[model samples]
Target chain A: MAEAQNDLKYLPLNDLHVELGGKMVPFAGYSMPVQYPMGVMKEHLHCRAQAGLFDVSHMGQVILRGCAYAELAEALEGIIPQDVVGLAEGRQRYGFFTEAEGGILDDLMFANRGDHIFMVVNAACKAEDLAHMRAMLPGIEVVEITDRALLALQGPQAEAVLAALMPATADMNFMDVAVMDWDGAELWISRSGYTGEDGFEISVPVAVAEAFARALLADARVAPIGLGARDSLRLEGGLCLYGHDIDTSTTPVEAGLAWAIQKVRRSGGAREGGFPGAVHILEQMTNGAPRKRVGLRPEGRAPMREGVELFASAEGGELIGHITSGGFGPTVEAPLAMGYVPAEMAAPGTVVYGELRGKRVAVTVTKLPFTPANFKR
Target chain B: MKYTEDHEWLSLDGDIVTVGITEHAATALGDVVFVELPEVGTMVSKGDEVAVIESVKAASDISAPLDGEIVEVNEAIVDAPSKVNEDPLGEAWFIKIKIDDVGAVNDYMDEDAYNDHIG
Candidate 1:
């Protein structure tokens, strides 16, 4: 298949995906591989049991630089909800860009790389995210690295596969960032991943992207994964996919992401932080968080797919919520989903019913991270 | 032994025509993650929905090539859907239908013609 191009752009590995017999689809503007030769189910399972590689170069990688690390952090907190002011050097935090009405702009990962905040965010939301940052942190500079390719080597053998190429990187723990020199490329390597597995996300220049991808695949242990598998893999891991799970309309609290808010940031008049939705967010944090997010395990052979209606109480069940992401989890060997219900029914062990084809299917409210997370913390 | 233009193969010795997805079709479908079987003794018409086959992308309905009644089903694909991806023409038969008119098999394209059409 020829590489597809639109107003956005294509990754350097886009041609490689086509050459590898991948079914490419347009996602977030760039033509992306949705499934490859092994297909989505096998790829999903393979990533769970072994290892799979993903070309996530479409996501915008940015660098924030201006002043001291502390000053830069403070500048960043002007827009985002995380207490960037308290972020230690060389440490990373998961955070959100919030709107005034307590809605999330986008969920992202931020790393304090000593001098600047090195961050990666969803491809679909990158434009707005970068603009939001530039507008909010006027002193700090934001650079969009479009000439780069991001690949995620995710699963149990992630570190091992990466270790073959970068010896010291393999030793890095989760959320740690190390800029290592590989083949004349100053690639940034992070022991981080979306799948609840041990993995590394590498940022290589477009020129080296395909070669690096080929090098990784040369190891019989690594397989080329596509977007379809990526979705299922993250879903099985109980991680949220940006558009499907959270968007500008959803709040971090309602999305069950209150844990990411630093306790100090929530303290009233603490450092007088200027962040979006800080007031409402602190209120939600101080008082109990309403409408917690929970994992749902449906009891049956049929899948309680996304957009399916959820109900509270078993008999004469009242419609209360809807599934955001749902699928048959090959790893868990059952139908699974992530969605929201009333705060009361969001607790683990709560019994609820999902209406599929007008019949109420039995489901049990379960804790998030339904599958045990294997991140190398 | 016969094939349909849509790439379904059937071999009939009597009223029962052993059926399975064609190799070409299976290869295109990639890995089959789920296979739904029609109940035995259920009446089926030519071009009627006989079963459901789900790959990683989405579930698709498998239609019958000839009018018949389902006499047996290959439940094996339900347990191991990848069997279709590996050996679609041999072991991944969704169902065997008792043909209402054995002559209807003639309506289906032959292997040579089916291959030509598929190609």
Candidate 2:
């Protein structure tokens, strides 16, 4: 049985979501809408086929400044493995805060906003991440943007829908950041999102956020999506959720997020092994981690949820791995999951078994993003 | 039809009993994707997990409310699981059981009581 949600915080769009018939649920200590009248299945497919609006204001937004570009970037690089100093203006890159032993603190995105760097960290890790940043960069100023609401307009038709109102939105490429105006209101728009589909994340003032969200939903192509669809979309896109996939104990190399780590930060590069966990991470880079994250496709419709034990064969076999994130991928129209397994058995096509109750269900190791990513690169 | 604390409903007719999850359970589960039914002739005690219902978001166990032997399982639900979400209290009944003791059925709540319990 689930406990009562008496202390859940409400989003700025909470009233609007309720009026729109969203089923509210407690997520990350917030009263977030998990789905609308269309349900998760339809809402997920809608985002893939057309456009959907998501309220992602729960994420922490911050601006770091009061220092030189190289200094600020170097300060951030001391904690993370990503090459922040090399990030060009108006460009965003995904990075993770790591521990001394190659464990991830949190995964986030930082964009070089020309004068200052703009960052967005996971909602669950916001407070801790802020404290960590302030402690690390004592001289640098960390400003939390609290009076803004973040909305994601995602899908194949996302561009067309936003471009009709703000024509400049269509010109932005993937990972590009810019400031646009809509009806006399300033919008910090970025061409990036968790969903693999081409989309834009718009940051608007809380005062006009309701009006802005309503305007987007009024468009025929845009439907108001909830957290349920958001999770499913990111799952199908092979994106990691903070606590479930990448956590304090999981390393970037083991979680398959090594791509987010730039070569300049690794061994044999200009800036070799300066960040936290660089010794262990670089070692893992050269000599691979014992276990690696991989995708799983169940033989049947049963979804192998988090913590489901995985084995090598139908009969008694050695415990190989455990599912971390899984669900019925509405877009993939099947049960898809991501889990950790021995490096040798992580290859695609390796057969595994999910222990459901007392039965062993067959699952095949497959490449991630069951549906191909449609990012406008 | 009577309901248990776990949200399963049972229909008693003579010594035979039919079991399924309530509408509230189906709604909470969102969309039903698959259902693993217990085999016929299996004897189950009260509170024993009999069936597994897999939804898009989660997988839940349906427990037996009264001691009984599985008489028949709903193959229609196995063919199309969404039927449980569509008509959970009616056509989507999970399994039929031959009740060993009729007195155990009294432990379940009636329709009005079950509705209030869910509320």
Candidate 3:
């Protein structure tokens, strides 16, 4: 057990989390806090009602640079289906790297940072994503950023909290990115987050990470939230957790992430079908994928968590799908889940059954997210 | 009160023994969201999983401590599972079992021994 724990890496704010009575657990090769003294339930509710500070430094932050912005955008567009060339400066968009078979390698958020492109990939897939980018786009310089710690300040009051620290942040809208100066530190700030709340993801130098996090926590409205609450929050937001909700086996269309693919990348547009798996992806776009991701609300209080098989009827029948992510939504105050089902069974009012233990429990196909997003658009 | 290695506590009065999870288990499980109790007339043996406890983080099973027949089950915790986190020792008792031997409770760890075991 000791040897296994020694294999895990510690975060820049490890000491701070321990000091705040955080319960450390291993996640994606890092020993991260799962919850604090406030617990997951309260931490989740706090992020929805006020503001929550999250340490997301374990995710990979990379800067891709080329001879020119257009050249870099074109090279990136070869891998992802999003219209990278059309992405304006200071703007970020959600995207995923696809395999030749239309499966998702990893989902990421990339921004056009004027001179270079800034990309953030999942913690678990960072190493593979970097290798894929380096191997595919040899002309572009893919530099991995290791000297920075990422923090997400999220919720309705996130704007007020961050703007108080850096007043320039007040003007930035959702999906906007900027390099703001804070006490001589270069803070790469983005007005976006995973919790479907109006928020900012700040990339600060590791040297000042703890101090900046302390500054945020000092505010009465902002509390340190752990990965436990983060999971429930994003789950309530109808967002995907890479390995669970999406992976190498699921396509963007089946995952219900078609919005990330702009019209220019689709069939009848200017720069259509240049990415990997574009043939299958565009075909699915024109027609439809057999299965689609949908929100699920279990009728009973018991949570129908991931891997619970879904059926068409309460009695014995063939399994239609299974839950990918699920838990008690603190904001919704009910057990909610997301899963894939046949397109015919994916409607909002459609009733499905989840097999729990040995019994069949009724689950309704509800529209996501369980709670409406509070993003400042 | 006696405790099992699985963090279940048992309190006996005559042949009937009330069973519930210890405070240590409750704290480790975080907030309880839902609970499924065994039927009142169900018979169970030692180590038989009789109840299910669902918390925000994960799901766990409550096993029967000794051979017995469930005489009563707590419906309050089934309705409002938060009681298991708020008052684990008192109101959160899951089931009452009429055991064959009253001396079975003595075989488990006492309060001090259980504290040391948890420590």
Best by lDDT: 3
True contacts kept of each: 0.38, 0.62, 0.95
Model 2: per-residue lDDT, tens digit, A21-47?
999888878889989988888899999
Give the clashing pairs for model 1: none
In model 1, how large is the Cα lDDT of residue A322?
83
State candidate 3's DockQ: 0.94
TM-score, model 3 to reference: 0.99
Q: Rate residue A74 of model 1 by lDDT.
A: 80
**Could you give the CAPRI-style class of model 3?**
high
List, residue by residue over A108-219, the lDDT tens digit for candidate 1.
8889899888899988899999888888888778998788889999999887888888889867888888889888988888888888888888999888888889999998
Q: Each candidate: what lDDT? A: 0.81, 0.90, 0.94
> Best by TM-score, which number?
3
TM-score of each: 0.90, 0.95, 0.99
DockQ of 2: 0.67
Give the CA lDDT, 0 to 100, for residue B43 in model 2: 96
Best candidate according to DockQ: 3
RMSD vs true structure, all candidates: 2.9, 2.1, 0.9
The predicted structure with the larger DockQ, 2 or 3, is: 3
> Residue B82: error of model 3 in Å?
0.9
